[model samples]
Target: MRSGFDCASFRVRCLHADRGGRLSAVERQVERLPEELVNKIQAGEVVERPASVVKELVENALDAGARSVHVDIEGGGAGLVRVRDDGRGMSRADTELALERHATSKLRTLDDLQAIATHGFRGEALPSIAAVSELVLRTREGETEAGTEIAVSHGRRLHLRDVGHPRGTTVEVRDLFGAVPARRKFLRAASTEAGHVAEAVTLLSLARPQTGFFLRSGGRRLIEAPPADGLAARLFQLFGDRLLEDLVPVEGGADWAAVRGFVSRPDRPRPSRPSLRLFVNRRPVRDRALAKAVSQAFRAVGGGDRGFEAFLFVEVPPHVVDVNVHPAKTEVRFADGRTVWAAVERAVRQALGEGVRELPRVEVAAGRGEATGVAGRAAAAVGTFLDRGSGEASGSEIEWGGAAGPPDRVAEAEGAAPGVEAPVPVILGQHRLTYIVASDGDELVLVDQHTAHERVRFERLLDRAGRHAVRSQGLITPLVLELPPELRPVLADHGETLRELGFDVEGFGGGSTRLSAVPAILGQKDPGPALERILRDLADREEAGWAVAGTRDRLAATLACHSAVRAGQALNRESMSAIVRDLLQTAHPTLCPHGRPTVVRVPREEVSRWFGRTGWRRS
Candidate 1:
């Protein structure tokens, strides 16, 4: 305390200070990142994996107006990837600038960004690839005497020279992620990576049907397609003639928007929904709204098993579509998603409506022959949906929903001759009180009771509405509730559609709505959430120019789902029979409106083999 500068005073004097005040202990330092590091970071966004590399290169090839594109790969593209294209190539100056960041010929100003037609407008693809791998670009302009070659590695230009070459472009990428060991370590095995590369090639080839595409992996050709006349021809070239059998053509449009594609018949099903490929403006995109529209169309056609196969191409005005939403350009934003959805759904439905009458019926017949298996006694024990009469089968048609009856008597009710034509499956016993097992001639059909009933009610409700407006039941007491601000626009937009679906909802002062009536089909269901769901759906895409007519069907589906019978509940044998009869009368009897298979037919011979009954000759 006696010195001129004490310890406390010295400590206070040693503290650092900004012009305004003393610096904090944990202040962060900031500076411009190195160019190499910046490029690497940006590359991470564009080039996610080997398949990403393939996507960018192919898109560039397309943007260059390539008529034929060849993709060659090795070691799942981790070893080598090459794309050769016969297109309008670039000159020496363009080749040099292409490796530079943000240098693109596709865009000039703000107007181009708003209406981007070309695929690789971002110009980040080549530079991004250059940053991660050893890249060599050899390009020759159409009228140039010679070509320009540029070699780059890890974002550094190694060499540039002139060479004699054809009027085209070839880009080769090797040692991908060699400089970045962390990214390389994440690469999958060669085969797995190769599958992704093949898929990417397939998608691009499908998008550009008129362009020839050839893809090879490990020197083995994976896909090859010649130029196609149209989308249908391309599908045939890609998927083969077998796919054509299951597909139905769908085409529809509004003033400036249109949708055209093929949807598989409800009967021909796959294990999953991957087969549903949707393209927007000639570019393949995985969009939820478009996919949902296709699915809804399938459900309307009664697809209640596995999902369906569909290829829908939606064409909208370039200005109305935004392709800049994602770096990959696979995802897009539409100005009026609801209009597009409505157009697609209507197209699919119209196609199905026209072809439903021509659809072939499912049939499994046992060839007429002596009981060579030597187990004729077991035939009667094993029930079938088809009752083959000796001369004429009796007890085939059962009076379902009347009263409990003997199984033999029920079979006799649906009497028919055991001939080429199979009778309706005789309702057998209910299994687990859920499935209705029925026997036709040589097959056993298992019917999901709940989903089947739901389909029935759904189709019936739709038919009722199509003929006349859905009836509304007035609520005893009007339910008043608060509405979200987003839902307000929905009310304004789809008020007529909601009323068409049997909902009477109106604004009840500030941010609240009063629900006075509900769809009579809903019965005792709470209309609150149903109405809210409709509103939320409507609000999700407000600018969709057209009033969403599908809103009625969606609500109808909800009502049907709620009203459908539950499993584990006991249903009389006659009631089960009635359900089956009603189901068969509907448009798509095999599946429910939700695309779940309501009925599955197991062949009699296959069942026999399961029980160790063999020695039967092939039919």
Candidate 2:
């Protein structure tokens, strides 16, 4: 059967007959939707959640030249949300038009879109918000005698009237997404949603230091930041003096594009990259290229493996950067992204150069605590052994028990065949208590004591874990750690994996965890720092979509790093010899698990060339 539908009246009718003389149904596949339906569709994109609503409203306030903004929320902003700002308010006519789609004073024409100086220019915030919630907007321009109040529900005007109000704007929203039950059902728990709202406000607060921001949830103040003198003061106000002292100032760039802000010192690394905040032209954003630039700069200074906390600001002409790329405006497209990346990298490198302290030098003393020449100082610094019979200084060679025995059982477990022997380097004196000086007949070898042991321990630990033989050391009293809400989910997801690696952890209500035991390999070392590092590594790997085997390897590597000997700790001859022997027995003798060189070999010919004896024969 064939039938036709009237587009105007949406009524079904039999229109024509088919080839078989039977009527068929025919309907218009495409038609322009009504304005109300259009607004509801736009709301799907502009208002993702309560946090999205908060972001749009706050951004509008900032664009209005507001010096102070306050936000209050209830039921994670799904029940009610109120934002008040002290700034230039709109008049009665403008206030009424503000609720209309595509009605904005910030954008005059297409050319204005290319150079957007304001936080909002699309003018879809008010209308989109009003489409899904009950909203009340009140405003009073400075010259006006009375303010205008408008009430709207689900994109329909309910009432409008004149009222007395301050010379600013206040917007109250209630029953967010009430008309759209599907969207409301997707919202998380109140606490989780509130955390997202807080994060959104925090980013905006950091972006604008001269403006004061206050946030309250369930009638309790969450964030209260007053106007700050500068970025440093703002950082101190938000994160306190400890973070302020850990950061180094960065300032440099060309006139076309400039960069400035603060980067964390090498020693103060955070577990994740969220601690690094980025802003362009006073707008907070998340850009992978800019973040990669910062990471590359920190990697040069021996950091960035774990993340670093930084607050970087980039200033470029509006025409060169497009902030309209994302509807939420959290992403940007640069005209010349490489140039901006280089500018950021160079500025951070310069700052690190000035902020990082010089490496410590080992001081040497002469005979009986008396000062000596360079040779005596060098010998003493390397801990030269004295001859027992004559009481005279021996050569650099340190006496070991004997040549290394057969391959270690850990190596055998790691795929090494039985009865296999690995060549061991002759143990020489230490170098600055960091490197282990050794000789392999034709080459002078230098081993990083820390990484050497790290490799050895890593292999052993992996072997034990594979065999389910990991040893645990129980604590006399359980240790309690208060974790952030974000980390609690990570802990819950990976709690089993943690226990498999010799960590006995259990949740103790209120976003805290109880630690009952740790890997015995940690020994007397404080397990707090190591446990935290492991948890962070697990979280990062899980987010990166690592396989189960890869996650296990990462956990073992983290445990090995904590149990290994420190760089500055003094090691005796036996300790050094054992590390060298075990390091060679491992499958990979040249590099550590983290890809750092465990041993560096300088050929005899290279040393001879340095001494200008490459081709000399007793001449």
Candidate 3:
């Protein structure tokens, strides 16, 4: 008497098929029951606190393939968090099951946990979200274009109807922990909670290197990590151009996993390890054991407390690590993380030994591109970085001053072709990067290697970024960097500062960043060298708290000295003149970013005395 097939047949099949499948019927029964119990279960996993809810919902959007996710929170995660994504939307029934515990399309069995690849494998995120907070999810799917809204409070689902929603999902949570007053009492200060929320946002944004992210709290935008095309592009977009300089490429794999990130040079260490970022399959993890191995290897390569920064990507078979280890997968347990550690150590060591880490950036002496005796050793140190990708094609030779990474280089290789005059003066009458230039004046001028050049460029771009939008050129090739857990925090804390200086700071996948665009001046050098040098510079600057204005000035002096250009480099005629002109246009051009006088013009008499043409004249 019954039809050949039944509508409920498909869902019923799952009851006997597997564990996750078996739970589907139970979940449906639970959803039909009083909504209170249902919401409470949902709240258990999603709204533990402000950051927890933020993390869950954000992950939901990310898993849905959101390219640009926006999070707006008020009074931290406690007041409200409205997350909207430009991903595939949900239909009426999809929205209903979405708010139920253990109901998910991401998994079908417990065995799925072993190879969990998506950001949200647990079906609990959305439901857990509706429990504690007044949750509202609005969406539209393919043909169900009118879109519907589902509201749940204290674990009860509201009616759905046509709502003004475009093509994706927009979830809003208000008064988090409103039902659970006890939980409210445990909340931290707004700023502290805001910081946690920011951190959560940063982590998720990093996991999806190509996805764009925006976070705002109390009506103020806290973070904006744009979608990058590739890993290096993402790194440059978020972390800044400094991390790209003098980068050593790391290419190695072991036990079915491959790892890649930048290693800082000996001169590039930072005071802390914040610059050391690491990612596994593009997810940043806090694996102490694995990070320890990196620390050891980094130390072996030489930059002391001033350690380096790397945007590393480690691709492992999904089964090797258990992503289900925690609600927040920030901490990972790889089947063979130790093997990863050893491989990283060896990769870095070999990179340094082969001189792969020091591709044409700071620390190289001032000279024509040809390597001298010492330069040859320096080149050897950076060889690993140079080996992997395309090397600079200029054949112009390495022209570097012992200086910090250019704020400009974090984005792209601005052509050597000079358009706008560079703000900084060059050493020995050179064009900005050309290193030499011609002048129309009677008196010949020598550009100060570092300060003069930086002064003009720094002021120009810093001002430009402030006045208009920050100008970031897309990099044709990206520089990938790898780092450990310890240094990633420091990078997070100081990301705002670096961004002001022209870096695109975001959590690159897990700990790895995909480099994208960069500033124009840095040219084609990778960003790791720049990050390494800045880390060292920051270490010196942070050695003392900005004690006072005087103290700050003193710190600036030190940073300037460390960040300034050093002696010995070749220059082309136009580059030299540009440096001279840029200096004349800037303040304190005579003195560098540090207090050192960039240039000390020698008098004709002094020049003559070297040949015994004249003696000192009486004043």
Q: In TM-score terms, which candidate is top?
A: 2
List TM-score per model, in order.
Answer: 0.54, 0.57, 0.52
| Candidate 3: stretches off by over 4 Å | 1-48, 246-249, 274-276, 305-308, 351-619
Scored by CA lDDT, what does every candidate get?
0.65, 0.68, 0.56
lDDT, candidate 2, at 398: 21
Clashes of 3: 115
Ranking by lDDT: 2, 1, 3
Model 3, residue 222: C-alpha shift (Å): 3.4
Write one digit per residue (lDDT tens) for candidate 2, span 233-330.
Answer: 77765555655766889999655779999987754423334366889998888898888888888777645344567788999999999887776778
| TM-score ranking, best first | 2, 1, 3
Q: Which portions of model 1 miss their true places by more than 4 Å? A: 1-44, 358-619
Error of 3 at 157 (Å): 3.3
Compared to the true structure, candidate 3 yields what TM-score?
Answer: 0.52
* Model 2, residue pairs in steric clash: 1-23, 1-24, 2-23, 2-24, 2-25, 3-24, 3-25, 3-26
Q: Which consecutive 10 residues in model 1 have the weakest lDDT in total? A: 390-399
